[model samples]
Target: MRHRRSIDLMPREDAADDGATLELLPEWYVLVAKCGKCRHQGRIDRRLVANRRGWGVSLNSIGPALKCVRCGNREGNKLLLGRLPRD
Candidate 1:
């Protein structure tokens, strides 16, 4: 006899659009942080951020907490969702 396993395709309640935590983000998605002051954009690694700030941290709370490495802009930072390449 062969055993079949079921996978959960639904996202959790804590995993909303933006208010979700780093680990809640799907594998096909990536996190990007942009600076409003300097207009600089950078890609964020979910595992890295989660390791540094823990997995339970909210995405919204991360934006303002980060400083733009380019212009050193500490305000008006926003977190955006980016998609990974299918290939």
Candidate 2:
């Protein structure tokens, strides 16, 4: 059986009420992605997210579809979301 992980998508839900829709999330905030396989983690720019839309990913489901640069895993739904540290 495959392991199932829970991710906190609450921030995005909260952001949505503040006019920060997923499609425009990158414009307003930076996102952190953690790999489910190798556990690799990194920051993903909002523009890159916007670009992902062009590849057919819907805004609502982008989180779980992200690929891990280190492991190339596609089980994005299990990916956690966190705020990037301010510069």
Candidate 3:
């Protein structure tokens, strides 16, 4: 079974009386994983890439990647990687 997930690559605004355009920066990429069989949705942080080297990899080599916690799907598991906007 395959599941579809919706990932928000935009910043979310909080409720405020001020009309100013507030830009919230996320520390990491937010990933939304959904189950196709049950339609269950879940979210995971993409910061895991930082620890890839496991020993001492330079921060420059670490790129942005997201994984699905629910479906065990990797960033390259499907074409969803390109769908995300570049920072």
Candidate 4:
């Protein structure tokens, strides 16, 4: 069975709108990725995401594509997009 992940942070169509609006998202995101098998979690910097345009791909598509550095597993890895705490 193929496992599909949903980019629930934003609708897939919404994310592909434009780079200018998408650029602002990285600033607001606390990118958290978790492995479904090992339950390992990692944080990704905004800068890393800012550089990748991934044209024709929505930001939602990027999260599920992340591989777990610890286990090198691609399947079952979940990406979480959370907002930074307001001061």
- CA RMSD, predictions in order: 9.4, 7.8, 13.6, 7.1
lDDT of 4 by residue, 1-87 (tens): 222333334323343444433354546556677777787878866556557744344556665677888998898776666566557
Model 1 lDDT tens row, 1-87: 222212222212223354567777678877778887998888878888888899989876887787898999999877766666669
List candidate 2 segments past 4 Å from native.
Answer: 1-20, 23-28, 54-60, 76-87
Worst 10 residues of 4 by lDDT: 1-10
**46-84, model 2: which lDDT tens digit per residue?**
567667565344444666777888878888434334543
The local lDDT score (0 to 100) that residue 20 gets in candidate 2 is 36
Task: State which candidate has the highest lDDT.
Answer: 1
Q: What local distance difference test score does each model get?
A: 0.70, 0.54, 0.33, 0.59
Cα misplacement distance, residue 69 of candidate 3 (Å): 6.1
Question: In candidate 1, which residue ranges exceed 4 Å CA deviation?
Answer: 1-18
Model 3, span 1-87: residue lDDT tens: 222324443212121222321122133434344443344445433344334533243222222233445665544322111135557
Clashes of 1: 0
TM-score of 3: 0.27
| TM-scores for all predictions | 0.73, 0.53, 0.27, 0.60
**Looking at candidate 1, what is the lDDT of residue 64?**
79
Mark the 10 consecutive residues where model 2 has the least summed lDDT.
1-10
- Give the lDDT of residue 24 in candidate 3: 26
True-structure lDDT of candidate 2: 0.54
